[model samples]
Target: MSAANKGKSREKPMASLCAGAIAGGFESFATYPLESLKTRLQFGALEGGKPLTPLQALRETLNQGGTRALYAGCTAVVIGNAVKAGVRFTTYDQFKSLLKDDEGKLTAPRSMLAGLGAGMMEAIIAVTPSETIKTKMIDDSKRAQPRFHGMSDAVRTIVREEGISGVYRGLGPVILRQGANSAVRFSSYSTLKQLAQGSVVPGSQLPGWMTFGIGATAGVITVYSTMPFDVVKTRMQSLKARQEYRNSLHCAYRIFTEEGVLRFWKGTVPRLGRLILSGGIIFTVYEKTYPLFDSIF
Candidate 1:
């Protein structure tokens, strides 16, 4: 094939990553208030330190942090998710291509496996540091004595005080949570979209509104499936110079034993809301932009 034809053939691989990056950045910024709330509830006192109700959390976030504070680590999130979405979309597509059968048939299980790989890749490359900064900012704001003035200050302080490891404190749980999350989210969304389109292949596109609704449904599924891991991840990451659990497994065991099995579901309300909206926005943007990028590339 000629250069033009070759570029055309590779359109998806070439542009999918870039398209995803753009969409991911915008989605994260657009939906950050929910994320801040999610993170706050995830670490706040379940029984102490003033009730952490959803409305109360929202009020506090706005009052204490201001509108700007609502988007505490927006830069980290946008940049991180740009990389995360880019890597995940590109990697997942590659994996799915490889997993397709001789007749170009891709099964749901294979799609899930690809999503697993893509999630893990993005977790390692992006989620760890992004989460570190984000969690820190929110956790700090809750205190009368805030830690850092801004993202740059937070970065410098964290690095100076705790070294780089501070940024990766809860990596284990992050990996597990994200890996499972992406797998379930992508597989379910794809399956739902396929069913709606009445096909096993990727051609028939759903209406934009339908896609958003389905994405919200998928997000609900993801939130419930991963809430336990998310709670543990937050606890592990949010320890404030006071050592909490020893590690991820310890964190899980402690939360289960000390707080009861039900305790692991902390932050469910905000998390559910955030993810529901997030899933709809992110996937809707991705699906709509994907073809545009493919054609342009």
Candidate 2:
């Protein structure tokens, strides 16, 4: 390859990785309170009780342990999401490259397929264990006698009590949720960006506002499409998984039969709030940062 082409090749993967890492970590940290709320709502849903509104849940969490309660599992998510997003974008780029046409263009279907693979890859490598730990920590914090003092304590306790399987409690639903999530978000974002730019050209530049808007739209679409899987994933990863849920399907069944279909979307408001912000933040950060990384690296 020409020296310029070789340089571009090297830049692509590294830029994608670094940009995605920063984007994911920043987004997760900024929106962690919403995530904490979502988990608590999902956990509450497992009890098949009257659903708490987002404001009520927020108030209850704050009252229970003050502002710190809202960030009970932030550390795990920020770290895990960083790694997961790094893997996600790098893998998505690789898949996109492979799936592109002879003209080096990617269609929507191919983009979705690439995202699907990327999502599944990230889920197995990072999201599953991270989410399990985060959920357990949040659950423990709700107890009369909380066990884990922090991230390390949570990890040690979970490992001692349940082994590796404990940290991977929701692998199946996580993979499904993430795969569908990426597929919808990435494909829609790509399609929306193209529409906004009025072109299908690769590396087409868009204004920051446009990128954020498109990303947020894509996130909303993703949240609605894959919500049930997300709820099921959270329940399966909870500390009481063995006692409350036989498996992902059983969890879904119970949620549907006992709590009704809407119960599967118990955490929608807070989760939607998070995703809206996360979509805007992650895509905006990644797009802006990638070029800088590309030039520097």
Q: Write the per-residue lDDT of candidate 2 for residues 183-268, one digit (tens) a residue.
A: 99999987887678674344457777878898899989999999999999999988888998889998999889977898778899
Of candidate 2, the 10-residue stretch with the lowest lDDT total is 1-10
TM-score of each: 0.90, 0.94
1-297, model 1: which lDDT tens digit per residue? 001111113326767697778778888887788888878777655325754787888887888868877777778888888888888888877777677676665578987898899889898899988888878776776676787788889889888988999988789888998899989998888777767766334444667788889889989999999888888878877745237777788878877787778777777887788788888888888877887777787
In terms of TM-score, the best-performing candidate is 2
How many Å off is the CA of 142 in candidate 2? 0.9
Which stretches of model 2 miss by more than 4 angstroms? 1-11, 199-204
User: How big is the RMSD of model 2?
Assistant: 3.2
Q: What TM-score does candidate 1 reach?
A: 0.90
Per model, state how many residue pairs clash. Answer: 0, 0
